[model samples]
Target: MPEPKEIGHQIKFPNTLMGLFKKGWWEIPEIMASSCLGLLGIGLGFIAVLNYVKNDGDNREYKKVYMIMRPDDPRVPRLKNPVYTQYKG
Candidate 1:
């Protein structure tokens, strides 16, 4: 019976940078284009996260205003006297 082949010994890895280039898998233009697109995606993602955080603060402010303005709303707690009374001159 034939001996079973070793699993990891068959996998070939380049020992040097020159050997890697000789493999025909590393094209300069394709690498540059892919890297640029990856950077652009990361930048856009960062901007989206920042915008979401900023908008979250604005949303909280709007919710506070809505609750105060519509005290009669079931969601808002009932109070004997309103928090913001008009100032009389």
Candidate 2:
């Protein structure tokens, strides 16, 4: 029977700075694609978070001010025996 060949070829690491640059040229496209995709993901995530904050944040702030300024307004529901008032200081 024929003997099995060695599992894999050895990767050659460059010893000099110029050799390193030359060896790494093949990986430039792969690196650039990964960087672009990462930036795109971050930008989309930022836009989503900003949109949520703008919409929800404005509504929350308006409700808070309305409740404070017009507690007796017909739109505001009246609470009997509020939780905060029940607590003895």
Give all candidates' CA lDDT scores: 0.61, 0.61
Clashing pairs in 2: none
Give the Å error, residue 4, model 2: 38
- Please write out the lDDT profile of model 2 over residues 30-68, one tens digit for every residue: 775687799999999999989988655344422334333
lDDT of 1 by residue, 13-78 (tens): 478986665443444667766878999999999999999876552434223344445646753343
Among all windows of 10 consecutive residues in model 1, the one with the lowest summed lDDT is: 57-66
Clashes in each model (backbone N, CA, C under 3 Å)?
0, 0
Highest lDDT: which candidate? 1
What global local distance difference test value does model 2 have?
0.61
Candidate 1 clashing pairs, residues 3+ apart or interchain? none
